[model samples]
Target: MPISLSRKFQQWVSAKLDLPEDVIMDIPRITMIGHLHLYIENHSGLLSFSPEEIRVLLKHNHGQMIIKGKDFVIKTILPEELLLEGTIEMVKFIKE
Candidate 1:
């Protein structure tokens, strides 16, 4: 499914409110490093990263990152993209 207008509206509101928008509205790019780390670009959602888990829900998949600690960051985020740096533990793709 495509992104909803409400998400775009939220993005606009976030921009206007000087708030950070969380929602992956476009095609995402994912990368894994050394089989222990992963990077996701163009992601959007309420992200919570900690020593226990890192969770994210994209257009097609929702998953958790198993990390040793809460030492992660959203490297970059734009209206159409985002960047996540951490260790990925699980990934489940939802079928439409």
Candidate 2:
């Protein structure tokens, strides 16, 4: 399939202006601080959350982000962002 005109335009603008593609493309941006904090922006959904695991869905069919850890807690959650606190052991991305 060919890229849509609007998406092409967005890419062009992002490159020309040095803008973040994540903001323009609705892709997820993940941030981790040490082994205790996880921040995610532009997440599409929260599939599952548990004390030992977390599963987040990404937008535009980007698939899922799996977080394996212990003593997990949700520090923050918004329409497009999530903040987690835990003893993060592993982080993995599974593309759909």
Candidate 3:
């Protein structure tokens, strides 16, 4: 198996300092509240947003995170995080 240099570095640093690998790697952290609210952390950018779906660009090769549902709305958008509110039916990741 091949290991990414960035991932190896993150793993080393995470072990050295006892830090969470996700934080060290700048990985996306998602929080969902009963399919009603979604919080995405460490997002690179917003790809698209609408009442039926929302797509966000994730950091690294995690690809685009797509939220599918109805009456989708973005409550807040920050440089590294976002809050989405709606009836979320599904969440999928598509690689670019």
How would you encode candidate 2's per-residue C-alpha lDDT over 1-96 as one tens digit per residue?
356887899999999999999978987898899999999998988999999999999988889999999999999999899999989999999998
Clash pairs of candidate 1?
22-45, 23-44, 23-45, 24-44, 42-82, 51-69, 51-70
- What's each prediction's TM-score? 0.40, 0.86, 0.85
**Candidate 3 segments whose C-alpha is farther than 4 A from its true place:** 1-3, 15-18
Question: Between the candidate structures 1 and 2, which one is better when assessed by lDDT?
Answer: 2
* Cα lDDT, model 3, residue 7: 78
Judged by TM-score, which candidate is best?
Answer: 2
Better of 2 and 3 by TM-score: 2
Query: How many angstroms is residue 93 displaced in model 1 relative to the true structure, after the best TM-score fit?
Result: 4.0
Q: What is the TM-score (0 to 1) of candidate 2?
A: 0.86
Scored by lDDT, the top model is: 2
Candidate 1 accuracy as TM-score: 0.40
Q: Pick out the ten consecutive residues of candidate 2 with the lowest summed lDDT.
A: 1-10
Worst 10 residues of 1 by lDDT: 62-71
